[model samples]
Target: MHTPKADYPLSEIRRFLEPGPIVLVGSAWKGRRNVMAMGWHMMLGFSPALFACYIWEGNHSYEMLRRSRECTINLPTVSMMDQVAGIGNCSGRSLDKFETFGLSTSAGGHVDAPLIDDCPANFECRLVDERQIPEYGLFIWEVVKAHVRPDPELPTTMHYLGRGEFMTSGAIVSRRDEFRPGNL
Candidate 1:
């Protein structure tokens, strides 16, 4: 026997709907550079490697990203949860997040945005479309370059569950044999 289900509030649906890893979005315009914690993003394509993320118009990084037309997605490990939450709670307009958080960065090869040196993986991307920004605040990007650490000791990542909760990535389970070559 199973228990009956109850409907949750519409506003609380995001806790269950959002299930992707959190990322630090880095952008640069003029001489200013900023990094913002972002949990609303997803992969759109595979062959060319495309991504889409939503950035509110009021965010400090919004204008910088729009003006520069490029950004970097830095994947932080589970251990960096405190910094991730801290970055999301504050605006990047007044303080330099990199310096405040003691983050190190390196220049991206294909874009002006700086990649977070502490992250195990960083993707350099260029904005490809903004047709949905007015209605959805969505930005589509094409990944131009990808950098990763040769070996990661603490590779666990975190996924937000709304509010102040987060779920850490755990053991890997693969179904490689279940898929055909063409499907992969």
Candidate 2:
């Protein structure tokens, strides 16, 4: 028999409909760089490699990102959960996150931001639209360059469940055969 569903709190809906994996957003402006943990990002398109992420105005990196108009999106794996948590729980206003966390970085090819060297994948992005920033803190971007480590085809990533909890990505289950060519 199918299980019965219970009404859930609207605020806690993220635990069920999480967007994507938690990522470390790298931003820099005028000689300063910062890393912020973010989970509210998603793939918005494919042709121009467009992406969107929300950043509250109060965030330390918000001003830098707005002025720099570029950033590097670093995808951290499950192994870096502790570091990810540390990055998220602290503010980048007072200290250098890279030095505090011992995160090594490399300069991005297209953007002025630093890419976390430990991350398996890093995407250089340029701000494309900011019309939603006033109404919503959304920043649209176009990925200009991307680099990935090839050893692990699929790396396990963390998904935030709210309330200081997280879920790790599990085994892959593909249904390629069930989808039409255009849909796949």
Candidate 3:
């Protein structure tokens, strides 16, 4: 069964329904560092590389990001699945998520937030705007810098559905390059 609001309700609509990369936002405040899983991210522009990700107002990571105006968005590989779930389930306010998940971190190029070393790719984001909605807030940012491991094969990225369910876009399927010169 489906309804119009399946993609409308901010709470009921399943987040991460669109399969993509698993982005972990690393943020720090004072001396505390926290990382959280976020899937509601998208590229809003290209020239300046503007991006936007949704954050719940109540989340500890959200608070840190709102205050710090800086974050590192890490794209984890398939090998880091368990650690990814641990970060999403745990609260940074109560637990040091980075340590609890056994994730290692390094400084980003432009932000103070630590970037997860396990991830194949990382994006350093600087806050551009924070728009408050009814329940969730959207943090608009610009991709200040980026880093990618020099590998021939790309790593699989994870995505979140609802209720702890996740999926990974595995293998490459392409028809764009498969076209042949044929008389149609």
Clashing pairs in 3: none
Compute the lDDT of residue 67 as modeled in candidate 2: 94
Residue pair clashes in candidate 2? none
Off-target runs (Cα >4 Å) in candidate 2 are 1-19
Sorting all predicted structures by TM-score, with the top scorer first, yields 2, 1, 3
What are the per-residue Cα lDDT tens digits for candidate 2 across 34-144?
Answer: 999998887776657778989989999999999999998888888899999999988889989999999988887799899898887778889999998878999998877
lDDT of 3 by residue, 95-153 (tens): 88877888878877589999787776677788987665335588888877766664633
> How do the residues 1-184 of candidate 1 rate in per-residue lDDT, one tens digit apiece?
2122222232222222234789999999999999999888877766466789999999999999988999998888888889999899999899999989989888877899998877777788899998988899999988766666545433688988997999998876679899998654
Please give me the total number of clashing residue pairs in predicted model 2: 0
Model 2 vs. true fold: TM: 0.89
Candidate models: Cα lDDT each: 0.80, 0.81, 0.73
Residue-level error in angstroms, candidate 1, position 5: 47
Give the range of the ten consecutive residues with the poorest summed lDDT in model 1.
Answer: 1-10
Error of 2 at 90 (Å): 1.1
Candidate 3 local lDDT, residue 52? 81
